[model samples]
Target: MFKPIKSLAFATLGLAIAAPVMAEEVNLYSYRQPELLKPLTDAFEAETGIDVNVAYLSKGMVERLTAEGKRSPADLVLTVDISRLSAVVEAGLTQPVQSDVLTANVPAAYHDPDGQWWGLTTRARVVYASKDRVKPGEVTTYEDLADPKWKGRICTRSGTHAYNVALTAAVIHHLGEDGAKQWLEGVKANLARKPQGNDRAQVKAIWAGECDIAIGNTYYMGKMLEDPEQKAWADSVNIVFPVFEGGGAHVNISGVALTKSAPNKENALKLMEFLTSPKAQQIYAEANHEYPIAPGSEPGELVKSWGSFTADDVNLMELAKLRPAALRIIEEVDFDG
Candidate 1:
């Protein structure tokens, strides 16, 4: 009876002051070029009203993040390939993200077993061969490229490149270490030219008649089709799905995860959910010519034009774990030597 209403108001004010303020911004460290990822980011901002500030870098995003430590401004990390993502996890840079949406959208095989990161989209490591030079159905599997007949006719990117390394790891998983090493040596014997440039370069080499066959991601063909100078490069070759009779096609992914010290945890999670939603998944497929991790999302016309194939069911995480061994085999074979 003695306490006035003003006293209660003062106590409530102290409680409010002690409560933490929710963050409104999410900082992203992405290895992808900003322009390529702008659509997704813009959509995320528009949908969630969360401002996304991105730092785009082609290299050393991991080192940069490591340097920042707990003081890092980053709330999320987006990058391509399992090796790079695993590196972030190994560095203790990412925290376990528990999200039912992500778990339901991305298969267990395509994500970290510990919920550290999730694959957003997948790219098949398929075959591209000169239409005139290599007959259809003649070369049908990854192992076929190692055939002596293809000697001095295959072109590929450098083995040190993540794509090649992942592909090598897949081979290891399929055929065991010794068998994979033998296959690597055989593939090396078949190189038309020294490994150089990215996957697209291998296709261009095919067009120039420098090689009769090459291994590359499927999306690169879509990119080439949209490019004028590279259109001919796309035209000169035909895509072949290398279903490993028993195993499936080799595949890799671009994935996302929340940082360990997320300043905007809720917003970071919201972005992850939105990105994996059906609509956002479609955007990823259409814009990047990649297969959506979410099931049943149709790929763009360009991707549809490429047709469909079974992806290698071997868990991609195994590839990340086997990377060092695969890299060693690459060196032993002198992939660039």
Candidate 2:
């Protein structure tokens, strides 16, 4: 049962021809652009003969979903952050899914305990250190980023951005609120410049000799390497996995959930299950340069070359819970100013 297609953002993937009979389809509201998800959706459509329709959303997904309520054509939601996924669940926009296939493919630490959402891929929040300026093993822990030795030698994106806020929330989970505050203050003191720019911009700063190291996600290296203009920036740095004092490296995910008002529940479930399978996981992860969470699905050659580290065992939903506190501390410190 197809509803009125309101805008160009909601377009059906051109993977397979529509069935002559009642065409089966699953609508997705995704933060990812349609082209980015084409590989995965194309594969799913080819395998199951279910058309995948995508609505690309930049922000305000919760409000949009709420406005549509039970009449929404959206069956699935694909978003990048744990906080976003948790927000949907908290807003009563998502329903818990029960499936042996999902549970077996995704690890317990990567999913909501109540099955509200499941992680598809993870990206480690890692350090990008200058190959010529920063020595190997010079920085081995997130705690060390606050050291005076690094004073006036670090660059990062705005503290209030979702990625940095998520990292701060992880720090809060590892350290207490007071400890996290001190860490934020120390990091602020060491900043080479005011917090500005996205993660890639930080790397460009390092390449331009503005800073010796920067906080960024691992996948950006792959992204930069592929870009003609940014390749030099990618070549100038080495990926480093910094750990918490007593924990493993910090990691975050891009995940998916079933919307509460799913019009095509069965087709959505089929697509969800197929997405977690090894083949789809590989396609999805490779396309986005992220780490696949499913068993038997390994990262691409470029990603594997970055090396590996044990991911911090803290359940991601806890990090989502700490986001507010993290944002409050960042505001208190005026890290961007």
Candidate 3:
């Protein structure tokens, strides 16, 4: 269920503008598409008997929250990527939540040190290699993507895209700014064409022989396999987890946070805890094709079949902090030009 922005009542001078409804409900402002969250939200609603109302925002989530201030009815904000999560926290739109369940389910590296946001699931930034054109062991490290040998065989989305920027930020963490800049330049010089299209489009290019390999999130392979029109694109490639030299694979997360202006705090907390529960985590893995973060929780069978790699040890908050620098380096290299 989704609530229209206009349907919410504002509180003034600590007084409600309209009488409150009796039924328990939690309002969510989410950047994640609603369909991806339906199963998890439905399960939470069913088990707790709490109605879930979602307002999907494509952009300006921070701006809207800032404008609403104390009048905002949103109890929680759900989004993907650490950068967006950090932005909301930086804006002070979210409040820190301390819970034994959240702390235990999410590894320290995947959540905020101060508990501003909690990671629910993670997805790796991996390579999509053509099964026919590329051999296994040919591409093993993030550094190898810049090799001269594969100069004309690579494809990617825009350098400034959040996914790529996060990957660049991870590179910055591993090798200072100077090293990361050079690597970006190397990768730019290796592009088969101007960085254009989404991650799945890169896979389509592989099927069409436009390129041999491309960088994309691991879950996209699952999505592609599910689409009849895109199944061939998925079947044409192998999922490859590349490591940052001396580090493991780079990954990002889908996370949730409690808003500062929560109208139904207790119910919102219940939903947050439910999101990290083993049952909800399993639904997230099976329904959305993401890797669950809960203790003893495992990826759906399809995800498990793709194989696994140790996640890079650097905390995601560090990557969020470096995003600006990463964008600067990407611009300096004229990666899309």
Q: Compose the digit string of candidate 3's lDDT tens values, residues 129-209.
A: 999999999999999998988888999999999999999999999999999999998898888999999999999999999
lDDT of 2 at 206: 97
Task: List the candidates' TM-scores in order.
Answer: 0.92, 0.94, 0.94
* Cα shift from native, residue 192, model 2 (Å): 0.5
Give the candidates in order of lDDT, highest first.
Answer: 3, 2, 1
- Weakest 10 consecutive residues of candidate 1 by summed lDDT: 1-10
Q: Cα lDDT for residue 299, model 3?
A: 97
RMSD to truth, every model: 9.2, 4.2, 3.1
lDDT of 1 by residue, 224-272 (tens): 9999999999999999989765888888999998998787789899988
Arranged by TM-score, best first: 3, 2, 1
Model 2 clash number: 0
State the C-alpha lDDT per candidate: 0.83, 0.89, 0.89
What is candidate 3's TM-score against the reference?
0.94
Which candidate number has the best TM-score?
3
